[model samples]
Target: MITKEKILENISKIRVNKKITQKSIAEFLEIEQGSYSLLERGERDLTIDRLLQIAIFFKMDIVDIITYPNKGSYNKENEEDIKAILQIELKKDKKDQVMKLIFGDNSLEILNN
Candidate 1:
């Protein structure tokens, strides 16, 4: 039920956030760069095994890379969206600046040490 577009978007986001090139992911996945490109473009499908490796690479839950089959993918309500993000940011302890940017307060239980 996951959409190829969403998978591509998420992969792009993760790679860019890490400042990694397709070559890097290809290397990380131990695949040819061209194959990785095809995968990114949805010309190829990601197997569960490869997806598990990606999950470990990103240190994320498998469900993250796999887009939910639910319809209306994006959150329409601002409050619900913000709350969900705050919870994740808090749990991940991503960064003080990012947490502040999202929640406007750095007093979260998960502090940047």
Candidate 2:
């Protein structure tokens, strides 16, 4: 059931949710904005190499992109990996804020201890 179209939709959703422009993504992929538009619009084929490029741009695992918000591979191991990635990308104070957003108020308190 996980068609290429579905995968494209998931990638598009991530880009939009993150407020990333198609032009920016296009530049990152070294393609024209119009071509990137076609990809997001499902008018062009999303090749494996391009998908891997996009995943790198987003600092995400391909599995993370395919499963996305539901995060099908999000077991304890993945959780730790995700936290480590976030730690590198975020400042100490910002990490707590992000953890709070994702895990509720008490989560940060527990994490800090």
Candidate 3:
């Protein structure tokens, strides 16, 4: 499951890791710093379109924004899958633990990417 706090933290981490300033991100997104700050602080909720733009800017998926798995209106099977992935991603253990739990050997592709 993804929370606003988690989303904000991950976004901040990505920005810092990439050595991109908030102003740079704003320029890329063509949004004002005030507006961007609100979004970062979770004081403003991003529309789906805006969210899509942000994800594209970061080369990330919607999954990264989600701090927690949300079953929402999904069917039982989908809900179960989300739950499983959440457990795998959230569980803190050795590096291989996440890979083994989430995708078994399928994470090899992710590593290469």
Candidate number achieving the greatest TM-score relative to the actual structure: 2
Better of 1 and 2 by lDDT: 2
Clashing pairs in 3: 1-67, 1-68, 1-69, 2-66, 2-67, 2-68, 3-67
Model 2: runs farther than 4 Å from truth?
74-113
**Model 3, backbone clash pairs (residues 3+ apart or across chains), number:** 7
Q: Specify the highest-lDDT model's number.
A: 2
Q: What stretches of model 1 exceed 4 Å from their correct place?
A: 67-113
Q: What is the C-alpha local distance difference test score of candidate 1?
A: 0.72
Per-model TM-score versus the true fold: 0.53, 0.64, 0.51
Residues 5-97 of candidate 3 have per-residue lDDT tens digits of 777777777777778787877878898987888887778886777777777887766665453234234454566567333342444456567
Give the per-residue lDDT digits (tens) of candidate 2, residues 1-113. 68888899999999999999999999999999999999988899988899999999988888888888776655746565664343357887887787888889788568769
Q: Is candidate 1 or candidate 3 better by TM-score?
A: 1
Candidate 2: C-alpha lDDT: 0.86
The TM-score, computed over Cα atoms with residue i paired to residue i, of candidate 1 is: 0.53
Taking every candidate in turn, the Cα RMSD to the unseen true structure, in Å, is 14.2, 14.4, 16.0
